[model samples]
Target: MLRKAFMRVFSAHPIETIAACTGLFMIVLGVALGTQHGWVWFWGQVSAVFGASLATLAVVWTVRMRTTETRVAANIDVLARQLETSISQIHKSVKSGRDEQLPPSVYLAQLEQCIDNLIGVSHELGEITGRPMPYDVIEMMTTRHTLQIEAHLAEGKPAPERRLVTETDSCPSCKQTVEFQIGNQPGDSAKPTCEHCGQRFHAHRSTSGSIFLRLPGASQFTRAVSVSCPVCASKIPANIDQAKQHSEARFCFSCGAKVSIDPVSHACTLISKQDKLAGRFDAAGVFHCEKCGEPASVLTSNINGTFGICRKDDALVVLPAAAAQGSPKTDAA
Candidate 1:
């Protein structure tokens, strides 16, 4: 009864702050009268009246605060629905297997949008949970969204087939067959080694197009340097030093190696470091392709991690793997 009457007092017709206060005072007066006229009863009335007034004020504050919270929640719910709709559309478009059909910039833009939505909601959910939200929830949602799109392009994002040119009995580069020397004693017998001295270098041949360096700083559209192809009259720039990590932007487009990229035009300038581009340079680094007896060094971009290989022709190209082989390793996250 107190609650109903208090609410009525609050919402009463012709409501005024002072009139409401007066009604509240009268309600307390009635409670005091009901305890009878004895001195003990009169003191009890006083205590009850004071306690009830304080309780009423607290209830009023709580109700106002809750009502404001309800309005805010309703607005958030509206925005959440919009986020859900956008996510659904993105899911369909990305999974369509026609990324080529979409604009090139679309992928990056859409990915950014998807991430933004996920992040916004994650923060909001964190607020509701009143604790640090687990990263798994956000990760799972994003992973599913990203993977679903890639699934349509490459069969469930399989491990790209990597074909490495391994050391064989016959060197693919020199075609010199390695032979085992006959030794009477096993302990002193050196295992079968490369017959060709210095030419025994392991030349890896994988069409999988290994990308060891990618320049995120490089502008869109392919960049080129002035160099000629050794095999063909391809006027492409080649730089032998492009194999170093610091020289990816200077990588050549024709030979798949790092070159000196022109800062203004984004063109690569050929630099001759061919003395080290053979037989043993990349024995520590990744690239080991030794075409024309010249093994070039390699460079990888830090941001995109696109690998570049140096060429004897003093040119670099986007290191590509064998055409029939699988995709190259990427430093892209």
Candidate 2:
């Protein structure tokens, strides 16, 4: 126990330990001198050793403080350099995006990467300075850039006027009707918090330029039908509105081919290959039309069976489904 205590004390106070050892050696030498001469000489040596130890402690503490300050200054310099580099990268990305007219998604991704680097630097600076990093400014700038990207993606078109949409169904949390505003373009989305129970709602615009609202846990009540893809013959699970008996187009995960299925009989028909189309699916599985390159919308009825609809300029083009054993037809609407 004594050895461990001595080790702890020596590790915590190395200058004190050295001074103690020196004082003990001087005391032993004084005892030997006292045996030869007098005890008064030993007491004088003890007082001198005590004063010298205090002087050593003060000198050591000053040196330690200076070393700590130097290290801290060096760390701050490195962090500042890192922050400057991140900002430079952001500027370069923005300049290239403007010059090349990059796609909105690509530009937004690059900007986000730069912002992440800056945020990392900010966190390190906060740790070194012992202050909280203010993220409000960063968040505001990100939101502004995102909105600008969204506008650019809209192809210079003014966004549709905002309008309140009341949910037809009640909220799952409180069983109260929720109303939210949606002003997103054909490819954007909005998330609004529920007033009654604080639940969040997602509002998305489809490729066909239709807006739809989704409530939490709403998918559990949705019905799905299994059908085989006409292109790859792979099984695809497609969602359908049971009450309205409406079916929408779905992409086959196996072959990446868009197929339309009948809600009643689950008859699948090929619409077009994903590579030949210019659209993307949002998080809610709703397609967003980037360009009307081909017939991409699905229409199914008792008489028409399954067909694809495409909008080109001012006219509507109808494309008959490519069934396994039937001739395809094309019509203009």
Best by TM-score: 2
lDDT of candidate 2 at residue 134, scale 0 to 100 = 69
**Sliding window of 10 residues with minimal summed lDDT for model 2:** 324-333
Compose the digit string of candidate 2's lDDT tens values, residues 205-323.
44344545555442211233468888888887544432223346776655557787775677788877754333432332222344554433432211212223344422222322222
> TM-scores of all models?
0.31, 0.33
Candidate 2: RMSD over Cα atoms? Answer: 18.5
110-176: candidate 1 lDDT, tens digit per residue: 4444544555555455556566545432243345334434432332233333232323344433556
TM-score between candidate 1 and the true structure: 0.31
Question: Which predicted model would earn the best lDDT?
Answer: 2
What's the residue-level lDDT of 264 in candidate 1? 39
Error of 1 at 313 (Å): 38
Which parts of model 2 have CA positions greater than 4 angstroms off?
1-43, 59-63, 137-333
For candidate 2, give the lDDT.
0.51
